[model samples]
Target: MARATVQDVAKTAGVSVGTVSRVLNGSAAVSASSKEKVTGAIRQLNYRPLASARDLRRDRTMRILALAKNLDSPIISEAFRGVGDAAALSGYVSLIAPTAGDLEREQQLVDILRNGSVDGLVMFSPTMPDDDIEALATQLSVVQVCEIADSEAAFGVSIDDRQAAFDITRHLIETGSRRLAMIGHRAARSGRLREEGFREATAKAALLPEQTLFADGDFDFHAGRRLTRELLKMDPLPDAVFCGSDTVAAGCVREITGAGFRVPEDIAVAGFDDSIQAEMCVPELTTIRQPAYEMGRLAFEALFERMTEPGASRRGRTFLPHELVVRDSTKGEAKA
Candidate 1:
C-alpha cells in the first residue's frame, strides 16, 4: 500500500501546496473556506499534522516546555527522553529547561513559561509553590512528576516509595542483616518515602529500629562519599547500609571496598532507582526499580490528552508500581 504525501493532500483539497501547508499549520489568518477544505482533505487522506507546521500557526504555539532539576542525573535524562519520544509521535515540540537545583533560576523559568510562551508544561521535581502551580494551570496544561506531595495539586505520576522502600529493607532483613542503617536524601519526596518504607519494614520484622547512622547527601557522589566516611567512623559500624539512590550506593560501595570491607560479607548495600550504573559496579547494587522511563511516557501522554481535550479528567491519579531488584550487593543473609 502506498502512503499519502503532502502533494497528494494539496491536490485533493484543490489548493496549492503552500495553502495546504498553512492550513495544516493552523494559521489563524487562513480563510474559513480554505481552512475547511484543507481540514476535510486531511481527514479524507488520513494526513497527520507536521510538528514543524506549529511554527506557522498563530492561534497556537504548539510548543511544550519541560522544566526539571538534576539534569546531570542519568535517571532524569532517560525519563525526559521517554517523554520526548512520546511527544514526537503526536507532533509536539518540547523545550527542555534544566534548573540544576537553583531555586531562583527555577522560579525564573516558571515565570517565563507562564507568559503564554508554551502550550503545555511539565515540571519534574519543581520547588515552585502551590499557588504558582494553580495560577499557571489556569492558562496552560500542567503536570508534575516525582515531587508532588499534595493530591489537590496538578496531576502527577508517582511510585509508592514508602512501600517499595519497606519491601527492600525487609528483604535485607530477611536475608539476616541485623545492624541496619540508612543513608537518605532530605530534598526529594522519593527519598523521604524510601526512608519511611525502610523504617516500616524494619519495624515489621521486629528488629531493632534502625537509626540513620549515615544520611545520603543531596543526590551527589561527594555527599555520598562524605556520609560514608562519617558512617564508617561510627562505633559498631552497621552491617547493612540502605541508600536513598543508586548514585549514593555507588559512592558507598567505592568507599567500603577501598577501605577493605567486603560487600555482602562484612557490609551489604541496597539502593533505589535501578539505573544503568546498578550493573556497572563491581558488585552490582541491589536496588528498587521505579520505572522512570515508563513514568515519563505516561506523564507526557496524560499532559497531551489534557491539552487536546479540556475537561477530560483521569481516573483518581495514576501511580506506577515499583519492584525489588536483588543483586550481589545484598547477597548473603545475616544471623537474626
Candidate 2:
C-alpha cells in the first residue's frame, strides 16, 4: 500500500495541508478540534511522517543531548531513562554525554552543543559555575536536572535536597542517635545542600560540635568505605551515618557489618537517593526518595517547551518533593 501523506490527511480531515503539518509537528497554534480530526485521520490511514522531510520543514536536527556528571550512577540512570523515554515519544533522538564532574569537560561539551550539534541540551548535576550556565542559556535551550542553576534564565528541576536531608537527620535524632556523621562529596552543590540540611537538623537538636563527624569524598562506594573506616577511628564513633548516595550507603553498610556492628542498633546508616541499591542492602537502606525519573522528564519537558515556543517565558526553577523512606537501616520510623 502507498504511504499516506499529509495531503491525504488534510483531505480526510477537511483541513488545509498546513493545518495537518502543524498538528503533526505538535504546533500549539492548531485548534483542538482540528487536531482531533487530523489525529483521527492519521489513525485511520496509519500515516507515518518522514523524519527527513519533517527535519527539513522544522529546520532542526530533532536531537537532544543529555550531559550527566556520572552516567553510571543509578539515580542518573533513572533520570536518563526518563529523558530518553520522553524524547522518543516526541519523535526526537536522545544522546548521553558523561562529564564526570569536570568543569573543563562540561564547558567543552557546552561549546560543542552550541555549534548546532543538537536542538537542545539537558544537564544532570552540572559542575559549571552559575555564570557559565547563565551565559549558555542565552545561546541554547538548556534544562538542568538534579542541580539548580543560580540564574533565573537557566531552567532546572530538582528536589529540595536540603530539606530532605534535614528531615532524615531529624528522624535519626528522634530515634536516639546523638553522634551523627556524614559522608559524601562536599564540593558539589547537591552534596553541599545535603550537608547543610544535616547540619541544620543536628544544630537544632543541640547535637553539634564534636558529636558530628564529616568526611568528604567523591560520591562512590570506595569513598564511602574509606571514609567510614576513618570515621570508625574517631575518639567516639558516630552512632548514625548519613550518606550522600545509596551506593555510598551500601559501602557503609558493608564496612559497618565487617566491623561487627549492627545497622540501626549499633550504627544507623541513612542514604540519599532511593536507588535499587537501597533495597538490595542487607538491612535495607533508609534513604531520601528523590524523584530522579520525574526530574529528568520534567527537565526535558521544560526544554522542549522552550524549543517549541521560543518566545515563552523562562521556567526558572522547578522543585520537586522528596520523601524519606525508612527501612531497617535506621531505628526511627518503619516506613515513610
Candidate 3:
C-alpha cells in the first residue's frame, strides 16, 4: 500500500489541504473542531510530517537567534527567559549570542546566523547603527527590544525610556533633592534617552547648570563606584544621584555608605531597570520597572508572526509600560 499523502489526510478529514496545512503548522487561526478533525484524520491515515519534506515545502528551520550586549546582566537573563519560554511553546528553539557591543563581532555573528541557521532574530539593546540594523532587517525578520532602531524597517519592543527617566527624576526632585547627578553609559541609545530625561526634569526644576552634574561610564558596578566618588568630590556635592542601571546604583549605595553618608538622609539615590539588585541593596533602590520579560516575549511573538505570514502587516513598534518604584533609597525629608 502507498503511504498516505496530505491530500489523503485532507480527504479523510473533509477539509481543504490548506486547512490541514494550517493545522499541521500550528497556526492559531484553525478552530478547535477543525483541528480535532484534522488530527484525527492524520492519525487514522498514519500520515507523518517528514522533516525534510516539511523544510522543502515551508523553507523554515524552526529556530530563532537572540542577541544581547551582555548575558551577565540580570535584565538580559530575565528577558531571555521570556524568549525561551515563548519559543518552546511555538515548537521552536532559541539560540543566544552575546555581542558585547563590539560591532565587528556583531557583524560576524549576523553573517553566520543569517546563513539559514535561524528563521528570525531578536536583539536586546543593540548598539549597532540604524543603517546596519535596517540592512539586516531587509535580509531577514528582525525584532529589537530595549534600544530600538531609529528606522521603521525593523520591528521593536520597548518601554518609553525617556518618559520613565523623566518621571523618576521628577520623583526625586519632588522629594526635595535639589542638586542632582546622573551616572550612565554614553554608548547606548537607552542610556542617552535616560540622560535626556534626567536633564529635562532637572532643567524644569530650575537646577543650576553646575548643580546638574553628569558622569558617563559602562553602566556597571565599577563605573557606578568610580563616578560616585567623583560626584562626592564636587563642592556642595549632589544631594541625589540617578544611575542608568540597578547594578550601578548598588555600587553607588556601597560607596556612599562607606563614605559615612546615610542614604536618603545625606545623598538620596535612584536607579533604572528595577532589577534584583534594586531590592537587594542595603536601603533598597528606588528605580524604574521596565517590562523586560514581556518585551522579550513580545519580540519573539512579533517575529514569529512575520515568519509565518510574510505578507502580513508588520508591527513596527511595540511600547510596553514602565513604573517608578519608590524605595528607601530615595524616600526621606530633604537634608539641610
TM-score of each: 0.79, 0.83, 0.82
TM-score of 2: 0.83
For residue 23, model 2's alpha carbon misses the true position, in angstroms, by 11
- Note each model's CA RMSD in angstroms: 8.7, 8.1, 9.3
lDDT of 1 by residue, 2-33 (tens): 44555678799898867776666566877888
**Maximum-TM-score candidate:** 2
Candidate 2 error regions (>4 Å): 1-57
lDDT of 3 at 156: 90
Model 3 Cα lDDT, one tens digit per residue, 227-320:
9999888889889999999999999999999999999889999999999999899898999998888888777767866677566536568789
Q: Clashing pairs in model 2?
A: none
For candidate 3, the per-residue lDDT at 256 reads 95
Best by lDDT: 2
RMSD over all Cα atoms, model 2? 8.1
Error of 2 at 221 (Å): 0.4
Model 2, 1-336: lDDT tens digits are 966656688899999877886787778999999999999999999987544335543777788988988777888889888887667656678999998888898888887677887888888888888888888887679988887878777888889889999999999999899999999787778899999999999999997589988899977899999999998898788999999999999999999999998998999999989999999999999999988888887777678767776676356898899998999999966783
Output the better candidate (1/2) by lDDT. Answer: 2
lDDT of 2: 0.85
